[model samples]
Target: MEVVRSSIVLSRGRSRLTVTGVLTGLLLTLSVPAALPESGAVTPERGSAYMGMGVLAHDGIARGATADSLPDSRTGQTEGVDVSSYQRDVAWSTLYGSGVRWAYTKATEGTSYKNAYFTQQYTGSYDVGIVRGAYHFATPDSTGGAAQADYFVNHGGGWSADGKTLPGVLDIEWNPYGGDCYGKSKSQMVTWIRDFLNRYKARTGRAAVIYTATNWWTQCTGNYSGFGATNPLWIARYASTPGTLPAGWAYYTMWQYTSTGKTVGDHDRFNGGTTQLKTFASG
Candidate 1:
């Protein structure tokens, strides 16, 4: 839920090409837009940004719980973390030694911006024997979801059957822009998400992991429950426990418990032990 100032232009056609400004030193050119369905007929009042950039920008705010509070290996859970370019030059060895069993690196944002540090972070974590995955920060308002999915898959977000890599993730959280729900109604948001997931699945032969917060999902999507059965849920909550999950998902696969962790970036946990974690990554 970071705010990036992007400049976008829309053209009338089956496909749209966009050139986005450099963000955190990453420049991107996007060319993928299928016929975008109009936003839902009803324009609901905008909701508050769930994980607003302003909140994440201030690290001084008490992060409630730390990685130390998590259940130990005896509890059958595995430790992990997620990073973006904001965590520059990560010490992969240090993280691995610190018991980080896996990692998910931000690869692309919107249709246009690609993370400059994705390659190093992804491969470095893998070389250190950490299960790794790549995620795309979604901007459903910019264009059609199918187009964005195509763009993401073409980039580092593509999935492989290699047992060390987890399937790609879709990070659809609070919008940093003025509108909380990105101006899309409940039904429209669902449609956009479905489009993205369908295309991503078709390309990778696996469902993408969804990274979202409970508040945002409920407010923006009207608590839609369709994706739970197929896509794995990666819930972000800053407390010791995962609290209440969004509708549809009976359980969470991964929980991002804190943004300011003792070891580098956001601390996460796999719902199960090392063996189950490997099985999850193998898909």
Candidate 2:
């Protein structure tokens, strides 16, 4: 989620370096491959982390979800959170004591970046009896979906048959980059998404959860209706109600209600009870 940047400077005979020298130095510095973060180091970007207030404002909701209560009216809703390296040193036991029953941590982004804290966060959550899941932030414009899926699975996005582990989630929401659709046409976007879902299902033997906002889905993929029957929808809507879902999904499996929740990370709720959540994870 973070982008690493490097800077270089040069000097000549007690004077500042010339433009040519500076440019040469810049080129040389850029040529050296940027080192990825060391284990437990923070990545440069935490996607959607800082956008919580804006999203909630767009929905006309002044207050974000609190740990004191569920975000929705649904009975038996299970509380959860999704975390990345931005959330440092989480108290998993405290979260569990506060009724957080599950967690999904960022495992990989695009095809190259892996969350440095994935191991600790995932294990810590599971150790405290929280159903744990891994998620990948999609960058369809960067590479083919199948390739990214391979990268995700090979890194840490794969699922096991453990009843306490949920299926991997694919975060295909608004591009933090300038282009909302990553410059891909709607059809191309849908094709890339389908490719990712198909490859992930083939590899893990379970459908991946799709995380997206209603407006982003409509704008980027023309509100594609194909994946709902196969993939569980993890809709992101920061409102009192979940509002309307994307096409083809009658109900959302998970609703991410707020990023600035009382929990240490983004707060979410499962649409069903403990048994249904366990069943979903068992897949």
Candidate 3:
């Protein structure tokens, strides 16, 4: 995971754009009607791309499409970052003035892999005045749904009344690393995800958001009917133009479309719809 950060920052300009975790006592403003970049020619920089220390991945929605060409306009929404220990030491203070209103800190992984940077990232984000939430990486190997919920509540820090800590998230993605996840079937993965959400909500009294890709929803968790309304969706797609998915995707509340996201604490991290920040925190 550490290597992924390095890969994301291929250029110095990109590095400068990353948000740091340390804040400088700035109040976050809730702005509406955000601006959309003009529909210009698609360039390599405008497309979706992901880079980690050793992970050079690209899932560009279109090879060279401009922003205005995308389906949904990312205007009038809150923009933010999802971070982990990978960018631990980065200064979070920079986010305050960098157009970031919300952040999601990785709190745990599986049932036992606690993120070492949770305290720093979570508190740091809060201190900087950015509305933030805690997230967990889902895995089938652990004690499963209910068990994972226990780990998150007990170890991932309690939720906040202001909803800053958020209802939490379940990151279900393909693991290329050495594990039972080398190539887990989509159905099997969705079953485990639902189990985890069921237990997580039961324990926290809050709905858990699903952070996944368009492909994941269509291929693995196609039955949006099963996930239900209370379960908010956080869709991740690396596309130049943004748009809504199918009806089953109506539950979606956030969309992550950029990876060259440079902020104060996080350099070359993932970025998403600004509306998500407002909706998650109801700010």
Candidate 4:
């Protein structure tokens, strides 16, 4: 359907706007916040960014794990899911009924954006018996690791020994806005991540979980294995198995198996059972 455009265009050094266009623009301006940046330099609506949004956006959805890569068994693994502002007001009760015992909610990004739905997604899951925690989408190009870590914890990523609250996660992956690794060389990238992890540990007394894909960790950090000793790994792979984890760990704590989950959000599997999961959370 073609839009009908029949209006006199105002001519001046200022610009050109049809009489009808003026009314529409006025209404839009009045309703929209002037604070929102009109360019790509700023983060989008609060909570809109989710884990793997960049993975599926910049890297094709088909890039990761394949069906043949699945493990022979997933027996006794705890069901889990991850959510962000992208899935506003998730069906926590529904997910709980479906056996999703754990969840991670996007809490902050860089030093700026914070998930607007942190409360609903974070606390709601807890209320429904889901052990829950928050995550920070790292943007090394935008701020120092310590700053971003501070912002994340201050906003929603803080951890406690409570059995219901899992440690925060550091979502470091392909840069959705630009080059992979946020344009940092392997050494610099590793340094930034160290800053974040150190600050996070100082603040919360728990090493935040490191969430990344094998390819990303290899590419961005040059296959650095230093972090595996301290931080638990939450491996992301759209494939069957978490697929050859980044250089460090012998095992993965949680595996985000698919971005398109069976139920509400991205599906994951805890590598352990109830007691193990609680122990991991408490520590």
- Candidate maximizing lDDT: 4
Pairs of residues clashing in candidate 2: 1-45, 2-44, 2-45
lDDT (tens digit, per residue) of candidate 1 on 94-132: 878777889988887677777777789999999999999
Give the clash total for candidate 1. Answer: 0
lDDT of 4 by residue, 1-283 (tens): 1222244221110111211111101210001001122253344443345677555443433343343343325487888888876567998887787667899999999888878888999999999989999999998999999999999999989998889899999999877555777779999999999999999999999999999888888888999999999999998776555668788799999987655422266667899998888888898
Q: What are the C-alpha RMSDs, in order, of all predicted structures?
A: 11.5, 13.1, 9.9, 11.5
Query: Candidate 2 residues 1-283, lDDT tens each?
Result: 2232333221110011111111101210111111223465333353432223223323323245322332445477888888876665688987887678999988887877887788888999999999999998887878999999999999889999999999988888655443567789999999999999999999999999998888788888898898888899988775567888999899999988755422277678998898999998997
TM-score per prediction, in order, is 0.77, 0.77, 0.68, 0.79
CA displacement after TM-score superposition, residue 16 of candidate 2 (Å): 40
Candidate 3 residue 275 C-alpha distance from true site, Å: 9.6
Clashing pairs in 1: none
Count of clashing residue pairs in every prediction: 0, 3, 45, 2
**What does the lDDT come to for candidate 4?**
0.74
Lowest summed lDDT across 10 adjacent residues in model 1 is found at 43-52
Candidate order by decreasing lDDT: 4, 2, 1, 3
